[model samples]
Target: MSKKKNKVRPLPQTVGINVPGVETHAHLDMEDFKEDLPEVMARAKECGIAKIGNVFLGPQAYETNRSLFDAYPEVFFLLGVHPNDADQYTDADTQAMRNAFKSDSRLKALGEIGLDFYWDRVPADVQEKVFRTQLELADELDVPVVIHSRDAHEKTLEVLEDYGWSGKPLLWHCFGSDVATAKRILDNGWYLSIPGPVTYKKNEEAQEAVKFIPAERMVFETDCPFLTPEPWRGKRNEPAYVAFTAAKVAELKGMDVNELWAICAKNAYDFFGL
Candidate 1:
């Protein structure tokens, strides 16, 4: 047989311990995984990812792609209209999401929502309106809210504070901000999900924030097909790559990589009720 030409990369399992870990955010149903999704899942399993939270951009994606993970009960979901698509948010979509949450037990949190000021795709007013509407939906359903804040952290904080989300089941996703912002989120009694960007050498702010953030309040995510951590930084990110993030986080906190992996996994389980 002719030798395959694929380059041999380091296995994430080499960096990760055999203990069960959780990937808090991923978009497995996206086109990036379309060609090798099964291989992706197997790699994730080999690296000790016992569970994964697949974030669907909107209710339509959820309804259309929910079946992708039917055989993999280890994969749960996070559904919401992203701030970038605020203009498309409508009542029918809200109702569909409500119905899915009620009927589908795998649906965990209403999230990856909030604001994205870095992108000027949607008008600010419309984004705010859709965000509040989804917030109301999560509150009414008594489910947790997962936030996606970019350069709009201040305004996002103001909205959440005014809505009385302090001490509520809120998670600040992709937390790449400074220590002060992290402290603010912690003060509100919310959990923070650090993403792969934390591994970059230039991200001193994220490093500092992750260093002191209490173990109990900290969790991890890959946000695959987006932010890939170092050692595999320029490649297409998959769930298994979260091990690199765990290693970086553990290094920053002066803890063992395997131990930190398990701790963050447990925190993810608790926060998402997995």
Candidate 2:
């Protein structure tokens, strides 16, 4: 008997219309969109993506993707060193990030920084140290922070608490935790950035989280080139696809999609001070 062949599904050539929304976290600096970045931005505008938070993984990413600010005025930046790259972080990189945020009006937040036990590319201690340093820097600068926690929710929360993060502008980006985790984040007065996973049929936890998280404390994101929502699960995600996630979240919240869109858009503007 012949073995069953496992065929890889192809991504869609294009996705649907952009409903008015804000993508709170995306890595547009990555090489995924180099060939069609202009087209992607055009589609994002057409789809009603009013603003996009382009997160930088490191200083080099900031330099490489800085042109995006000029190319798309709607694009803003979040500078930070991702936990996976924690080993390469340096004082000079930290200084440059501080300088960039100080000088650039468009640099909105210090973000996508936190623990990721899922991939032990960097040791936990080192990641924790880097995370703490950035958190302290954010506290000193009085700027909002965007955090990325994967399989480290408990530790992430503990650290946030230790840092005295209470009622400040903090966002748990690409929130993939349970309702309990959502409640903890809310209790801290921090915001949650919902991503494409909420649209997945099997993501009951995310759906539940959406139901419980108040619309005012909720925002949508694509985390593009990753976590593509339903109907486009196999595709390369983008800022334009944020609308799909928003629609899913709206469904879960038992509200009209347009109303949810307006709410999330306003929430994003308020959170980022855009």
Candidate 3:
């Protein structure tokens, strides 16, 4: 027999604790996972994610989120109309969200909501209108807000300045801006969530932003099914891969992976009030 064919691999041995993790933002309701959600959640648990903050982005995402929470209890839900979905927000949609807020404390935050002037499929005016409406709803409901801003940082900050957060908890998810923009968010007492793109070779802007932000205010995410980190960049990402993002963050912040992991988990717990 050839040496390659005769190779004996050792049996997999029991490993000690992997880094306890949290995927701060993900779309578990996305169509990609529709058929295999149980397997996906099982993988996440096996990889040591203590919680997943699922983004409710579709007409059905809220119901999907509710069902996940009911079924898994460990999964957390945050509701929002996505920027691309600005055209879909009607009085009925907003009311559905409000009713969910009234009915479930499992609904922890209002978001993945903000301006996306990048595509402008919806007019800037429409995006602003929907964003302001959601922010108002968040303030009225007294829940934190998770913001998704892309190529509209000034507009986003301007809207926040104009309407004023009025002491509501705020989070800027998938933060891809410069150090200045990161500083503005940090200065306003909002949290900044970094994602897998931080590990990309050409993502210097993201890396610079991560370097400047204070570790205490920083959080991590996969933004999965998108922004998959290196070595797995082209594959469909799941919460199980969040450690790669965290490892990248640790490299940037010059801390041990476990230290950063625990710090981020603590920040998430404090931010989401879990």
Leading candidate by TM-score:
1
Off by over 4 Å in 1: 1-9
lDDT of 3: 0.83
lDDT of 3 by residue, 1-274 (tens): 6456644422111112266667899888788787888888887877668899988894467875457556887788889899999988898888888999889887889998999988888999999999999988888898899999999999999999789873558989999889999888887888999888898989999898898988888888888788887757777888877777777778888987778878888889999998
Q: Alpha carbon lDDT of residue 152, candidate 3?
A: 90
Whose lDDT is higher: candidate 1's or candidate 3's?
Answer: 1
* Candidate RMSDs in order: 3.0, 3.3, 4.1
For model 1, what is the alpha-carbon lDDT of residue 270?
88
lDDT string for model 2 (101-126, tens) is 88989988998899999988999999
Q: Model 1 misses residue 194 by how many Å?
A: 0.9
Q: How far is candidate 1 from the true structure (C-alpha RMSD, Å)?
A: 3.0
Q: By TM-score, how accurate is candidate 2?
A: 0.92
Clashing pairs in 2: 18-47
Give the C-alpha miss distance for residue 92 in model 1, angstroms. Answer: 0.7
- How many backbone clashes are present in model 2? 1
- Model 3: residue 76 alpha-carbon error in angstroms: 0.6
True lDDT of residue 145, candidate 1: 94
